[model samples]
Target: MLPVFTTPPPLGSGDEIAVVAPSRPIEESKLQRACDRLRETFSLDPVIFETATKDWEWLRDNPEARAEDIMRAFEDPAVRGVVAVTGGDDQLRVLKHLDPDRLTSSPTRFYGFSDNDNLRLFLWKHGIVSYGAVLHPTVTVDPELHPYTERYLRRAFFEESLGVVEPSPEWADEWFDFETGDPREWRENDGRTWRGEETVTGRVWGGCFSIVKWHLQTERYLPDPGDLDGAVLALETSEDVPLPREVRYTLRAMGERGLLGRFSGVVVGRPQTHSPGLEWNPGDDYREQLRDEICAALDEYNPDATAVFDVEFGHCSPIAPLPLGAKVTLDPTVRRIRFQ
Candidate 1:
């Protein structure tokens, strides 16, 4: 049976949103722009936590400090929501310091992705609904927030529920150094593809593929397989750009854990085939090849599950934040997805 989660309160015009950094160090200038937009455009107040603007070394060495910021955010009734400044690789270290009861007591909407997925999942384990990372970064985009992003951000923040899940008109996979002031390029979105005939309705779970896999590996803060029954499993790769086979290995591990077979459907985001430092090239049909591997693993562990690929969500420009722990319907017959 799917677990029922307590939905956090919606944001009001003057509501306060806590800006925190649980993992990576951040640039104050970029963060200020995001905070400004939250105040001016979203009509919300943004309060930056002490840990958010700390230098890289300080953030790296101070897990307890990062955890303190998180505790303060949730404990403050004035702050209606909590969002990460950005994601990093070391958030696993910070999780140990969080007190589940104290965090869950307020049940404020928490948002993040990549490493921040760590906190989202932790909140999920306590039966509290939180959002995938989309709000903060979208506010800081160079030219402006894409309408697709704006539409979803509005729904996720102030509205009762994120309505329909749709593809962006255009998407970008590369990142530019914020100091350079160059805009990230956008290309026509190919949209999502369906691979099953059946329609399924289920609450959403899963986030960055690596974060989910790490939880399974460490058996840390993971929900019971029984709790995930009838869930729409949402998974995506980050800029780390794991090879196609590595994705399969993680999927296989989930299958072995008796976890993969419980989902009613799976949604995969577009994989970042190339990054600045990565050696991968797009000519190798990396996307298609990765699709095949995912299909193969699903066939082995979850043959009955519906699978959809290339639905933008994580590590991509113009993302639609998944309202984790909320119900969504995926109809492959017409190739449509709607969040309820």
Candidate 2:
């Protein structure tokens, strides 16, 4: 039997949350703003670790320091949780230096997505449940936190068990310039759609599809393929917004590795179809095409597996957190998801 992961105790108001950079250093202004939000909005004390504001050159050269900061934050009893400043491309380099013992020993809530997928997988391997959600920088600089984002954040941090996963009333397709500190904008969400039948209950696994490809290539920090049997796969694209063909090929690669068929179900986050320089607006039609492609890939490899599309966790705004390595029930018949 697979070992059961211990859920970290939830944080309350006034607790100190450590802010660290396991990826690239965040801009100083954005870092400070995030710290302010943690203090003023959440009523949590934010402890900024040194690596969060280091120069890009130093961050690139000091993977060990980045890993050490993570370990130190976990080892420190005073810190109730750890939050990543932002996701970056180089976090995979830091994984080699992290000690799994330090992570399992304390077992506190750790939150971040995209590049932090590396750390999430590391923690998952050690039987610790980490969160896939928005980073500190994005939350801090927003003029007002999206109610959807705040609601889920509160549930993740304060509740022992999540009730139901609901679609956000609205979602943002456009990217925000955090350096400019502008308020975010959003469009209406039609709601979630399912591609398979029946209910599937399993522990959640996987994150940014591109990051999963990186881990697959490196053969580093990934759970044993057998270990993921009966797990639910959660996947999303990043801001770079990989094309439908790229998405298909990545899932194909997983299928080729004998990895795709092990899952009982799959939950795909809303794709960020828009990028800075992309000309055409990829509206509902394009999203449906991407979903069809993903469904096709699943059909090719794991025809029996159930899949849900456009769930609210990913590069999009007003995101919710999904607990890595935690039990979740996906009922496609009712189009409902519940985190246990």
Candidate 3:
């Protein structure tokens, strides 16, 4: 098993949460809107760090600047938590510049995902349970943020524990870019699907499969295989959706490394099966296809491990901010996921 990780205190009214862009730059307009909502809804303070507003080219060139902004947020006594404005491609570069001591010294709350998972995994390695990027998509959403997502954001931000995770009323099948344009195609939610029997309780590990695969290949960011024993494996696909073959290969590698059998359960987030310009959906054909590969992998490597799919997280519109390394009970029989 891995070392014990600290779960940061929840945010409260007047608490200051720092917004930083460690992976990519966020639009100033969107940041302003999110901050306004944070103040109005929760009566909390939202502070913007340097990288969140910096030009894209500059942030890309100086990975150290990104690291500095993250460490700055962590080290600040006034800051209660840190958030990634959005996600991008090259966050692996920023990881090298980070000093674990500076971050862990303060032990403040953190929330981010997608490419931001790189940093989340880093903090996880150092024994700090980091959160999902609730403020990322919640920042610039049009009309208003989805109620499903909003509810989880509230729980993650203000509550000590996110009690029971329920299925969203609706699911987003299509969407626009973060900068905003057009409405998201909302479809009726079908809820979660479970495979394997028995309730499994453990700390959740893993994030966007592509990023996890990257860590697997490098072998630098991942913990020792045996260290994940009895942990629940959290898996999901990003907007840049990978085909089933890719999923097969990655899981095969995990199985070969003796990593697949370590998990007592698996929580697979909803995949972005349909993205603008890369439309490849013929009524859940691709979704089922991707799911099949994942099941195949689990069957081969971890036949007894319980896994639930399409649980509204990761790239999906309605997301639950699963705290990496935090204890959770995944009860397949009751269809309830409770976080502590």
Would you list the rank order by lDDT, best first? Answer: 3, 2, 1
lDDT of 3 by residue, 1-340 (tens): 5766898888888999998989887667777878888888768898988888788999989999999999999999999989888888889999999999998888888989999889989988888888886465755575676677778888888888788989888887566555556677788887788988889898888988878988998889888777698899998898777877788889988899899988999999988877666655435576787778989999999999988988877888778888898888988889888888
Model 2 residue pairs with clashes: none
lDDT tens digits, residue span 1-340, model 1: 4445888988988899998898886677788888888887789898888987798799889999999899999999899989888888888888899998888778898888889888888888888888876344656876676778778877878988887777788887777557776887878887787878889998788899889888887786888888888888988988778888898998898899888899999999887765777776655477798899999999999999998999878877777778778888989888898887
Q: Estimate each model's TM-score.
A: 0.95, 0.95, 0.95
The true-versus-predicted C-alpha distance at residue 179 of model 3, in Å, is: 8.7
Q: Give candidate 1 regions above 4 Å deviation.
A: 1-3, 134-136, 177-180, 282-284
Winner on lDDT (1 vs 3): 3
- So what's the TM-score on candidate 3? 0.95
Query: Model 1 — TM-score against the truth?
Result: 0.95
CA lDDT, candidate 2, residue 145: 76
- Model 2: CA > 4 A from native: 177-184, 278-284
